[model samples]
Target: MTELGYRHGEQHTPPPARRVTDVAVERFEHVFEVDPRLMTVHVAQQLFPNWDTLRIAAGRADHLDWMHRHWAHTVVSGQELLDDITGADADGPPGGP
Candidate 1:
């Protein structure tokens, strides 16, 4: 038996680690009612018709880093987009419009 418990002499390769792209795709699907199996490149193209696949992939890491920083800053800075979307202003009471 192989280390992965396959029959003798068989080869096995593990799946790749989940990328930030996968999380983005999952979120897009959940929020936009897109098909779960739709590829990330398709989603990007739909959102940004001018962007090519290679350019999208190349910016993934930098975009993720920027998002992380934005989220961290939002946590410290208080409500911004979410507040505006929900109609809850900083001067208004909690959950108020």
Candidate 2:
């Protein structure tokens, strides 16, 4: 018997549970041109805290690539926060002031 208290000849393996998360992480790669799996979840979360879209929007070209790969249009803000396609350093908060 193991820690799970499984007896001999008995398959104690539990079934695979659904991947549930409340932090709202991106799951799909919208940019089909590029491979999404290239970036791992750890790196994504590390580079982008809470999978923040603003970081991706204001980051380098590669970061932008990550954004698209993670389904930017759906996972994050649903293509609503994109105010300026052109990356510009503006004062005050994003889309404000």
Candidate 3:
């Protein structure tokens, strides 16, 4: 028997739950055409003010740490934003062009 009362060979595994960051990344990428993995803190703060508020209210330190790790090493540029806004060619950089 398992913790959930299932037999040893009949344990049921639940489907993986999507993380909040995953959804945020997907939406941010879809709208901005940028790899959200490379988003800067300023950009993330601007784009996800609601998420920030929720994190603070919920006291989700883990989520806050995950967000920091998500955008730890990259910076967004003006030219990249312009390219995305103007529908320019897609050859600028890893996250945008």
Candidate 4:
């Protein structure tokens, strides 16, 4: 009879622990509601490709510093466009006038 190599009691490396920040918690509350495991370190890294742990823990992180660098420009552009629309509306003649 051939011996089996697989063991049912084998132990595996545990996943890294996650400590979500207040900002992340607030923004991702709904994500947590839907998937409580979304706050894991691995998931955070996957979602935020360019995140810098050092910066986050050191309190020197900028608004967009630890975010995915690829999305930075897109977010900024969108915000700028929104601001432009707001400004245009504010400058236009009053609707009831």
Candidate 5:
């Protein structure tokens, strides 16, 4: 028989734990209608760093689609969307349409 130390077929070995985060990352492609996956994640993090990844992904899908439909443009830049929708100038922050 093989030595017990580092032997094959160890019953004590534990299975790898599943992670929701990894699933979210894999499912991240669903956001393609918004923009590039990595770019969208980066911009989202910048806008809401404290947000959960799942929340961000869902919010992005809703917010981007809403803005695209209402504003009549595909936007990757949050600030640009804000400025355009709110009619804000380069020097001013967005307020309203």
Candidate 6:
């Protein structure tokens, strides 16, 4: 584990705790569908590289920080794409204007 908080063979320093901001609170508001485990998994994909899905999001501030830095972009983009697809899917086939 390094300052980034990834698991590995040798010992390393863990990153500092993440602090909550109003922006994060606002962004996360109404985003109940995304699983907290997903955050750790996604952050692992980006920042932690070789990590697995065993990390927890509740007490680990480094994971949350990495998630904010890296995962948020993917989440927002994915949500936007899903929203577009959902909107289109909800509409019936186009009739002649």
- The digit string of per-residue lDDT tens for model 2 on 1-97 reads 6487535333332222233343223332321111224456645523223234333444665776797888666545535456443333454555765
lDDT of all predictions, in order shown? Answer: 0.44, 0.41, 0.47, 0.44, 0.48, 0.43
lDDT of 1 at 21: 62
| Candidate closest to the true structure, highest lDDT | 5
**Model 2, TM vs. native:** 0.16
lDDT of 6 by residue, 14-84 (tens): 33334344223211222222333446744543333212221333336577677889857644567887787
Name the top TM-score candidate. Answer: 5
Candidate 1 off by > 4 Å = 1-51, 73-97
Order the candidates by lDDT, highest first: 5, 3, 1, 4, 6, 2
**TM-score to native of every candidate shown:** 0.21, 0.16, 0.17, 0.20, 0.26, 0.22
Please state the error at residue 22 of candidate 1 in Å.
15
What value does the lDDT take at residue 64 in candidate 2? 62
Ranking by TM-score: 5, 6, 1, 4, 3, 2
Q: Which of 3 and 5 is the better model by lDDT?
A: 5
Q: In angstroms, give how far residue 85 of model 6 lies from its true place.
A: 2.6
After superposition, which runs of candidate 5 have C-alpha atoms over 4 Å from their true positions?
A: 1-51, 73-97
Inter-residue clash pairs, candidate 5? none
User: Tell me, what's the RMSD of every candidate?
Assistant: 11.4, 15.9, 15.1, 13.0, 14.8, 13.1
lDDT of 4 by residue, 22-44 (tens): 33332222222223355565545
> Positional deviation of 49 in candidate 6, in angstroms?
28
TM-score for candidate 6, residues paired by index: 0.22
* RMSD score of candidate 2 (Å): 15.9
